[model samples]
Target: MIERPITDWLPLTMKEVEKRGWDEVDIVLVSGDAYVDHPAFGTAVIGRIMESEGFRVAIVAQPNWKDDLRDFKKFGKPKYFFGVTAGCMDSMVNHYTANKRLRSNDSYTPGGEAGFRPDYATTVYSKILKELYPDVPVLLGGIEASLRRVTHYDYWQDKLMPSILVDAGADMLVYGMGEQPLREILKLARQGVPFSSMRNINQVAFMHDARTPLADYNDWSTVELASHETCLKDKIKYAANFKIVEVESNKWQANRITQQVGNQVLVINPPFKTMEEAEIDKSFDLPYTRLPHPKYKKRGPIPAYDMIKFSVNMHRGCFGGCSFCTISAHQGKFIASRSEKSVLKEVDEITKHPEFKGYISDLGGPSANMYKMKGKDESICARCQSPSCIHPVICSNLDTSHKPLTELYRKVDANPAIKKAFVGSGVRYDLLVDDFNKNNNDGNHDEYMEQLVTRHVSGRLKVAPEHTADDTLRIMRKPSFKYFKLFKKKYDQIQEKHNLKQPLIPYFISSHPGCEEQDMANLAAETKDLGFQLEQVQDFTPTPMTVAEVIYYSGVHPYTLKPVKTAKTRDEKQAQNRYFFWYKPEYKDWIRNRLNKLNRPDLVERLLGSKTGNSGKTTSSGNYSGRKKR
Candidate 1:
């Protein structure tokens, strides 16, 4: 690979392309986000990887799809193909809130602006590209394409939609992490294999005629899912399909997944194995400037870039497999950690930056303490299909040690240029509780807790408890609230021992599946007793490819296929969400009335305040006749 300056960002225009002495580009990539040449941004990482692989790549960020064909025609056509992405997050998730309200700001945009990217960004961008240059092949990837690679439930539309490739009119869809599949695709294309003939690559999905035989791909075993038409007509089949899709996704040796969308057969090849440590390190070691493209310097800072520019991602993938999360689905459940030497080298690089402030913002991944943590036996894990390693009690064969992570934290902070290193990502509090780690005889649980609370906390530590109800937590694949109680006790004890004032901010979700009004009331009363005002609360927003979303859309659990109750209506969901703000004076009367209607005065008194005897009681005559005759 040619050596480029660390400060050099990839070209964003034809002018930079000319300066590099490139007559024609091989791949012209388009995205729905402002160009930030940091590893945290997906577009930058993909472009840099392609550039390192001897391909001339140019990026068009946040292109205007509503206006003329200018943004699409800036670089004309490419020699190979056009790569399109919906930024790091799905466009619908970026544009709308959980309540389906249009969001006021986009973190991926310059100056925190909204409306720069259109709705359903991947499809919109791909459609514009095909319209302008009909013959060029368009490829789709990123979270939106990965999760929607097959028939999926759309929360905003409240309907089942076909594969995004069908809607976008793209030639191919690269699901999951794109490094391995992309390398193969580009290699095959460069060898004169047309994009249409490139159908056998792993982790790539495309459409075929219904009559096409499965034997065409003789090496892969295929599993046929219910057609998109069937899912729309019968939701039970839709729920059943999720079970097959999720199980295949986490398996080390997975089967190819197929679903019929209208008249076309959508075929998704099984993913490549989880990236090895060296492979992940190679992807991160690319020449990233770690700053937004210079064009955006005058447009105000990108909030997302500003937050993570100085941080080092020590690893990839999570094994937690929370039902409401897509991390495991997209990044795989196997943990792929960078070597300690690689991590420290990145830390040293960040320390030399002109913007370095003697502090590292974050040294973590999807779940911060999951570094170098995986099953004790690889052979056993290879054959296992269980989604979560910790849920339903931690696996006996799993290694839940925290010593390596603790050492990594110390090594990063030991640098003379650094003052402190913080773990900004949310840590799994369940792992710290004694009951969960009791089997492991490492004796480092308490020590790890002490180190975190003593040094890494930035005046506040964030952990998600999700909910207080046992039934809801079970549906969400989270441990019981009793574990949270134990973890909080430990956290508070460490703070007291060190004479520190850092607060433990717990995150909770409202209106999740299997939660009732009474459950939320219990949550309010319980947290209030713990002296928490409960600010970090959210109403559950169902995204694609999760157990919660399957249940929310089909009204049936994927594992059990039994009816699961959910709060679907706006009024029903809001009533449960209102309990989270029980500390506010404005919600006191409303909460009291709702609990009173449920005939649970015990909760009303607990959440609001205990009324004096006969002070506000009503009489049998439907009046306040029980009051004293004053």
Candidate 2:
């Protein structure tokens, strides 16, 4: 392996820019994350994509927003536009926990430090750029901007805020993956098209004066959502607006959406079709140092980078569309997979790293088993408006085969430089249960399970069943918990057949919409019966752009317009979460008292066991950990 020079990285400072012999840069990206030149990092990917297109790109990462305003002035202004992102994860989610407690550290920062970025970093950074530059266009991207592009709920603020464009005062916004729309934007900019005239581009959102006629570039039919003012006064109208936004977001051919907010109208164009094989491969095949910038050598490791330094993401986009998830909302429901060659090439690159440890951390995407899986029929998928392909029931048009993924894992393992490649991402367990998916008519399901358990099991295999109660599961867009039982039965058989001892860890959530105290008690009792003491649990926090979040704010399901009960108060949330730790001594008496008050002493006995000091502890079960997918 060759050592990379400092010049191998995208210029992060003026000194590095001077080394490149560039008097000025074309595009300057301001990010809330430290500059890690890896494809997994959004700032790095956007910078490299611009550089590939013959643009001089410079990055100002984790710029000081509170001090002298020097960081904003350092790069001055770019020739094209300034791109801003809140880093890999949303800043609020990074800075706060589910209980709204200020987190002590940020995984994306050097030394896992907090305070490197501000709350609503995108809005902060963009506002700063507009105030400082005043003349240059400010373009927004990344998950923070993408998910907040509409009138959505903000749990931290406990209010419904208008599109981020209104607050940020930016010229344009790119939603979703940004790669496809970015390329088109670059082409138009090269042709000398003004930034304000980019309304025709797909996946781009911007504000237009309400008094003017809305421009129709592609002649796309438009759907108007209830105004932000209307959502504030009428919760039912707010819930109804979400249904239109979600359906169009997942459709193959979608209508342009607009919403009135104050004097300006927000225009969000339909997204481009999913990326093809060569297109997605191009994004991954760019020149990357695959390391954090050298300036961070003494600051300690970025926890997010360290976790994925040896991993390979085979694809992007998740079709699971869980109610609490933002994956489909931001990445779209369609899958954009790389060619097998691209994935294997990335694996080879990992093995050549100087810190190569003969182990690959993850060889998965948004969901581990969703590689190369999509709708079996193109026309059917085009006409489909459903957000989840495998929730409630698996779509007959969907292809749930796991053969390609199984074969890919074998190829990676066969590389003599690699000792093991584990799938660290959460696997969609329902896809493996034949009773639910019914698409695994061939032996692919069993064969994939055997391969995964025998080779990829890194002590335990984690799956997310979310919750146990059927009523709660329905609102979560999850299959019945019975399917999880069948999946577990099959998983255990595979383990026994292979003579392996890997524990199967399942995750659950409390305080989600449609869940009640009795439902939580049932969850505790049912899991206790399985000889497991649950450790993986979380109280649901409502984030923007999710169905559960809408329900939490509006008190009704967006799809059905029916009232759904949610645990919102601190006491209510705490009560539901306590059920997860029923085995802990501190919570043992509380569980007994709470269950007795609910008038179900049977639950107290089932969870805490007979009063003769039955500890309710599992002798040899693995501890479950909670998952909060951003």
Candidate 3:
């Protein structure tokens, strides 16, 4: 391999573009995030990938859309096309909270500033580029476009919107991680193929006339979903469409999906196969500066960059497939892990950084322990249509071993330049429990748990139980709280054995679909009995392309079409959310009153102390036996 300059970050400005003595760029990328030349940021990865392919790529980060349109015209137009993304996260998630309130700061922005990027950033930027450069093709990618590729639900607007490709008036949209499809698209463009004629690429979505012929489109069985007009008039059809969308997304062999938005047809080409190990390893091995762009020096640090600057990602995609999560929808359920050699090389690169702090903040991916994890039988997995591999019960064919991840952890910690390496990503505790891994012979569940508790944890290990009630957990596609209890017991025993005082932080969600006020109260009482103050909790937010969101909006579960009770009104949501803060003095009276009205005075006594002050009387079922104080 030849050596390249360590500081070879892609150009971010016209002056930097001129420094390379290039009069024109082949590709100009636009992003909603501040320019950070790190792999963690999607725009940087795309820019670096294009550069490595011998294309002159320049980036326009967080361009001022409300200004005189100077930012859009800064690069004039690229020879190939303009790539747009809403940064690493979806734009709405970046700008607002679950309660629909605007956030005070954006972690992706320098100095944690807010308002740098507009809402619906991909659509906004794409529209602006089309307005300025009418002839230039606008290509949309990233989480925003990927999730909103077809007619889907929009939480902020509380409506079923058409595909973003239609709304933005862009030529095409690239869904999922763009490396594979993007390379093919650029290659076709170089061969003199026009953008309008480039609809055959996999993982790409585009609009076509409803009456277009399909016979000439090659070998692909097309599945037409309910039209956008029908979905707008009836949400049940919309919910039904998502079921098909999710199933096709995870299958090894899937049919091309099409939907009609009025007279125009929105066609989503089936995604390419999951990136092989070598392919994903190559992506992580790109020449990233591993630092923020120099232009952001005066703007203070980008919070998102600073958090993961010293960290490393070992894999991509998640198979857990929680109902509220979009990871499976975008990245797919297939886990694509990087080679150990590739990961260790990146760690060595981090050690050489000038700002090395003798610490690696994280060494994990979407789910920490899911590295190299997949189905034991490839044939079964290829035909499997289940959204979650571990849900309902861990699949017998799935490989739930933690040995690879445990060995990788030891290798990273052995580096002399590193003092400690922590696992910051949320771990799926169910995978670590013996009950869940009983089917696998060499799972080494005990060893992995011991190693994680003894080494990787930084004072506390975080896990997402999501909810305590079995009904809610089932709806969330998460394991029951019984597994949580078993995991906690083992965790406590491990802590005691090591003489360590690390706390197990469990995350929970309030006001989720199928969760009643009683469920929240039960959660509070159960967690309180376990001696948890319950600091980390959230009210469920309804995002697009998620089962929970479908249930929230349609009032019917997508899988069974059964009516799912959801807290829609502010008062109902607030009432359930208050139970999460039962320890607070102000909420105590409110919780007590709410429980009392439901004829559950026992919960009030359990959550709130009685006059006798013995923390109330405990029943055989672990709940308080006494009634509320008069």
Candidate 4:
């Protein structure tokens, strides 16, 4: 927001500096992710925003998310407040600890040591923030803070975290995209605004004594909201509309106990949009710094500099709400872009780096293809008001096309300096299948997408088929196996034609609440046939606000209330995962025969192990002959 506004903004910013008790210190934003100079992610982009608005900012690449004031002090007090979040927006709930703690109970672990403490990382981080900045407010935002904004079910801790706002001791929590919220915060801070007044700002969500119900407590129904015997039938009614609720704390009506101290609600006001024409370039000319300041910390929570790639923003928000996803719950379903040229300019600067080997990493917003909405003015039937898309199948009304995004990618790869460009992040295959694969015979149509995939391939391109079965995919709010099978073949055949080594990498998850032994077995069967190495086999770990996690932990999908086949113990699932690793011929002979008897002959060879005799021979160390080490 340059022009005179940002320049004029400095005076108030100075005032904000003094209000926060700081004296022209360069604020170093620290995080636990790669703050690579490139886009994709890091403090760099936000740093640029702050810079564009006429504030001083430095980036502290991946630091231990729990680093305290002393650890972060490498740069004195941030001129404003130091920004903190779980690295790369991935919550601590997704990580496990040495104690065998799974991030969440709902997290599936077909095979790994199993205890979990989803709150562990955030808690430790909260404690550190408190220890480091005793009085200085440590603002918590990003995905973790947004989703954890309320007191809800925590699958890992098996209890609750009060609310990151109260329990975490964060002075302010900004949910959704921080641009408008951050800008407002900066403006207010510079104007010497106080914490009590932050609630009034747009895009800002604060926790108060008021709270909403647990959405649907059917599964949690058996477990009281509190230790007492009371409970509510309609949790949605109890939702603490941040706009309506205000409080320090209160008692629960249903669970009937003094509601825990942390049961307050945070008012996350609607985002502030800068509609004025000047604000357009204002986003473009934002004075925030792109590269981390010269004094880049060598070691920290976010070692972004060390990562191979980066992410740049074109927009914010996703319209596609797969039920098991949190993008809607947190960011809302809106799309915001920072000018296409702005993104390209950001890429140019990245390519300028000597260490950069011409690899222009992904260029995307929430969903890469969704750089622009389907129809700017068309009425979008938000099929499901759910945090996730309510509809299982692709909504015909929602526009899904590849024209604009295709051009963007073309412009990027066209830069001869960039040896290759890849959309490494998740590409909504359903959208791709429609826009590129639907066979409209609509001019160079298929050829266009094939080129995009070819140019973006780096070893492999990742797409989340999540599962290979229709029933499981439907439950997971994803396209069916039919779609995955079709796309996989298309990609494979195309790769063969190009003679490129690039492979189609699909991710799979096991033990989702609704999945039973047969589902897992069916997936195993698909894996054998597909011949995919499967770099990632995520077990379903339920995040607090996620519908799936709720189902797994409570033994019921909150919406369906159906008796699911969630495994109660870890041992039972680990055996299933072992199946993915056993693909040898000898093992196959035994497994195939036995699996046939088990009524799961499909998984027999893959589970027991088998081999295609035609290709390169495996050496002694890696060699095998049916079930024997020799």
Predicted structure with the largest TM-score when compared to the true one: 2
Q: How do all models score by TM-score? A: 0.95, 0.98, 0.96, 0.72
lDDT of 2 by residue, 1-630 (tens): 235777999988889999999999899999999999999999998889999999999999999999778888787778889999998888898888888999998889999998999999999999999988898999999999999999988889898899999999999999999999999999998888988888899999999999999977787999999999999999999999999999999998899999999999999999888999999999999999999999898899988899899999998899888999889998888999999999999999999898898999999889888899988888999989999998778999998899999999999999999998898888888888778878889989878988988899788888888899999999999989888889888888888887888887888889999999999989988877776678867778788889999999999999999999999999999999999888888998888888888999889888888778787877645678656545
Candidate 4 residue spans exceeding 4 A from truth: 1-42, 56-83, 90-138, 209-266, 270-304, 308-315, 364-366, 376-391, 434-447, 496-501, 533-536, 584-598, 601-630
Quote the lDDT for 127 in model 1.
91
The candidate scoring highest on lDDT is: 2
Each prediction's whole-model lDDT (CA)? 0.85, 0.90, 0.86, 0.52
Write model 3 residue lDDT over 195-273, tens digit each, in one string: 8888788899999987876444658898889999999999899889989999998888888999988888899998888
lDDT of 1 by residue, 114-170 (tens): 998988899999998898899999999999889888888999998888889999999
- Candidate 1 weakest lDDT stretch, 10 residues: 621-630
Q: How many residue pairs clash in each candidate?
A: 0, 0, 0, 63
Error of 4 at 177 (Å): 1.7
Tens digits of per-residue lDDT, candidate 4, 141-181, equal 66777676655556555544456666677777776556667
The order of the candidates by lDDT, greatest first, is 2, 3, 1, 4
**Local error of candidate 2 at 323, Å?**
0.5
